[model samples]
Target: MPAAPEMPWLPAQLNALLAQQGHALLLEGPSGLGQFALAMGWAKALLCEAHALGTPLAPACGVCESCHAVQVHTHPDLLVLLPEAMQLDLGWSSADTDSASEAKRKPSQEIRVEAMRKMITFCQRTDARGRGKVVVVYPAESMNTVTANALLKTLEEPPGNSRFVLATEASHRLLPTIRSRCHSWKMAWPADAEIHAWLSAGHSTAEQVQGAMQASGGRPQNAWELLQSGFEPQAWSQLPRQLLQGQAGLLAAASPSQTIAVLQQLCHDVMAMVVGAVPRYFSQDSLKPLVAHLGAQTGETITQQLQQGGQSPRQRTLERLAQWSVDLQQAQRTSEHPFAPELMLTALLDQASQALQAKR
Candidate 1:
């Protein structure tokens, strides 16, 4: 129940959720839209001593003892469910387990059934602070079949004093029974102007803010994260040209998975341009030259070839990109497995370069 990051788009949603009455709530949307933060805010407000006393419709009173407990991650009335890896990433310590056994394996990315069983016990306990108990589950899709089934039973007949909040970036992946058991709310996407203003307040330059905004598809939380991670706006803008020229060093600093993600974005935008659609991840300026170069190599403008129809070089280029997209998707599925990082990057770069140069 630690305080979530500041996301401008979440306040109104949190307020709206606070005004409602439900035993279970599901906040669903794409990543970078603040689902986890919104879920934490809801859990905090639900357990806030001030809200329990009188201000039932207000957000968490930061000065209250309950709020203080949440801020310190010692809220007896609140439980947060996340994968072990995610718990480590968020700095939340997990319950004691077989350390010797766990030390021999990588941290799990799925919410284990054992955690769900513990949560069921937590639900049955009496409230420790006179306030109702709150259970917040983030990235709820991380719950495997067994774990989700255990949760489904709780949601079906939740304890009267316990409330649940489940948040996920991919709601479609959730069990239909789970989705049907909770009141679902879609996370809001912030406007470009709103995202820009928020990032600027962090002392980011206008150029940096704009670049991050576009790179994250206007997700305010993600844009701020990108900037905080020392994202270089110029390097991103120059990525397509560098790839076209076969300069794999542009992505040498990124991990194999990160490079694959970037290449996927580039492939996506170029495919969009070939099909006469707008790009979603990269700036138009960065992709236009790459598309033009592809067109020139094929001896016709992309738009002209598309208008002429019938397996033109533009269509063939799109086909190559489509196949590359498939390959990237497969790569993403196994990205967590150990691989030679340098070899992966080189192979991915070569595939991307050849896709861009595809003809016939």
Candidate 2:
């Protein structure tokens, strides 16, 4: 196969993982760590038809028929399982599946048991194209109980020349029994340097890249997505002040889940400032309100130095921001079923202002 380095699909950490041995590999980690990429890379390597060039670590010959097929996601032996919504969004469904004759409804968020059953049948069959079959279930935590249960039987036993790679952000949500059947490999985060290289490989300016990276909380994929969505560096930098000022222009445009997430990050940073821990998402200057006095009005810059050893104003502000962090966590859960958009943004802003203005 062509060199792994030449392939954009192989992250550095995933190349190392390709060398390992496991019939059923569970790639587990938080989102944006390239679990899906690693899973797909491994599958491509496993199913590559090149015998002379293939090895345990570098299995794909990028020039081979199998490699081309896998790249386009049309490899006959490969079955990719994803949530119904995700499948449709990704154009994974066949023409028949997407046909107008079919019943129309919102696609499911969870993997259905029927897909699991179909996977089982696919695995039992002889190799369709002389290469062994590969099954990939991305975000495996999307499997509901029934779907997971249906998969357990197949997972516990092996069919000839068949392999499974289940990639998930929340492995804890999977049935413990199902977990036991597969060898688990935790995905590793790429370093900041690697992330920067990946981000700047595109047409983005350095400032926009940096801003997108911080907005994504260091997730390279998320940063790339943000850049693709036309995030502005100036807007990202001014977001904390904007939220404080009750202006929800770009923030309100985000989905409820995303809006709450952004707010949660803001709350976390303020709380971090309160306790004197360096903030993760926001710079110290941006979180100055965390170091401000209670009832400090908007646009009125407070410059009183925090008392080194007394019940200082900074201490009082920290206390209130800490409470806001707790409240935001609860809010994060309910973000999936949000109130009317305008109301939700208003309430979130009000909560933030109240916390910033609280006394004691």
Candidate number of the best TM-score? 1
lDDT of 2 by residue, 128-164 (tens): 7776888999789999988898788788777878889
Runs of candidate 1 exceeding 4 Å displacement: 1-5, 52-55, 95-98, 300-310, 358-360
lDDT of each: 0.84, 0.75
Tens-digit lDDT track for model 1 on 1-360? 323247787899999999998889999988888888888898888888775465456788888999999988999999999998788767776757548887677778889988898899999999999878999998899999999999999999988899999999899999999999999998888877777776787777998998888888777777777888788899999888877777764587988888888888888899988888999889888898889988887787668676767468866778888999999998887776647777887778778878887321
| Cα RMSD for predicted model 1 | 3.7
The worst-scoring run of ten residues by lDDT in candidate 2 lies at: 1-10
Error of 1 at 300 (Å): 9.3
* Model 1: colliding residue pairs: none
**How well does candidate 1 match the true structure in TM-score terms?**
0.91
Candidate 1 minimal-lDDT segment of 10 residues: 1-10
User: Model 2, residue 92: displacement in angstroms?
Assistant: 3.0
**RMSD of each candidate?**
3.7, 5.7
Model 1 residue 68 lDDT? 96
